[model samples]
Target: MAWIHLLIASIFEVVFALGTNATDGFTKFWPSVVTLVAAAAGVYFLSLALRTLDVSVGYTIWTGVGSVGTVTLGTIIFDEELNAGKVLAFVLIIGGVLGLKLADRKSGTTQPAEPEPAPVSV
Candidate 1:
């Protein structure tokens, strides 16, 4: 599904981003190479997902997933920071994503619903 493809692309994006940070101003050869490979895969899969999903929705989903994943990974893996404010902000981001999914489901946006009756001819 498009969501799966988008999430896969997000993982690649996070990998590429982390690799880029490890490149040290492009002076590091191996890290740069990894960055390139991961970036290529990220773009390829993102494009594939766009084939079925609207660009706006696909882009937001991809960005949201990648951003959250990267930030969480940084904080947990590297112990960057996980203060109360930052944690609350992350919570808000998660809440926003949940709201989007729930709204889409409740609205039945995936498939058109029954049309309303035509106005009276009188």
Candidate 2:
């Protein structure tokens, strides 16, 4: 469930990023309005996941995934300039996100770790 919210947050980040790019320095009214709304939603869900997740870890994955998604979106949607360098950097970001997911699983953050029983004294 929390992971689902994280995914939602990532998608909202992409939407908000694209909205901002279209806003033209924030002077544009409608795009700016839309951007703000999307941004609010993005941050809200991000905060929701933080309830069960660590700040540094959650933020690392949330923002990393969002950043990579936004760039890929720009390339496909707006036909933006996507040179090899940019693609390589995006791939690195993706790899970093995957590594974090693996770490989360191993650390038992993705699932509740087993509880330790209290020791009995004689």
Candidate 3:
């Protein structure tokens, strides 16, 4: 399913992000290689999701997943600051993503276009 691809893409986005950080400006060989591979995989999966999902909705959700995952991982692995505001923002982002999903399901991907007006008299 498209959702599965999106999920994988999002996870890979996190992997590549962390791998890039670990690469030390690509000076490290193995980590840099891993980072590049992860980046490619992420894009590939994202492309799969985009085949059926709306671009705006799919891309936003993808970025949201990657962002939330990256930040959470940063807190756990890199010991980044985990503050109240950051937590609240993360929750809001998740809520927005969920809302978008529900809306897409109810309304479908593309909205109906308005009918063209009749030609005016000269």
The whole-model lDDT of each prediction reads 0.79, 0.84, 0.90
Q: What are the per-residue Cα lDDT tens digits for candidate 1 across 16-101?
A: 87888889988999999999999999989998877766565667677777778888888866678778987887788778767765
Q: Which one wins on lDDT?
A: 3
Off by over 4 Å in 1: 103-122
Considering every candidate listed, which one attains the maximal TM-score?
3
Clashes of each: 0, 0, 0
Q: Report the Cα lDDT for residue 39, model 2.
A: 96
Tell me the TM-score of each prediction against the true structure: 0.78, 0.82, 0.87
Candidate number that wins on TM-score, 1 or 2: 2
Candidates ranked, most accurate by TM-score first = 3, 2, 1
**1-122, model 3: which lDDT tens digit per residue?**
78889999999999999998999999999999999999999999998888878888888999998999999999999999999999998999999899988988888774444478999999
Q: Of models 1 and 2, which has the larger lDDT?
A: 2
Lowest lDDT sum, 10 consecutive residues, model 1, at 105-114
The CA lDDT at 91 in model 1 is 84
Deviation in Å, model 2, residue 120 alpha carbon = 31
Provide the clash count, candidate 3: 0
Total colliding residue pairs, candidate 2:
0
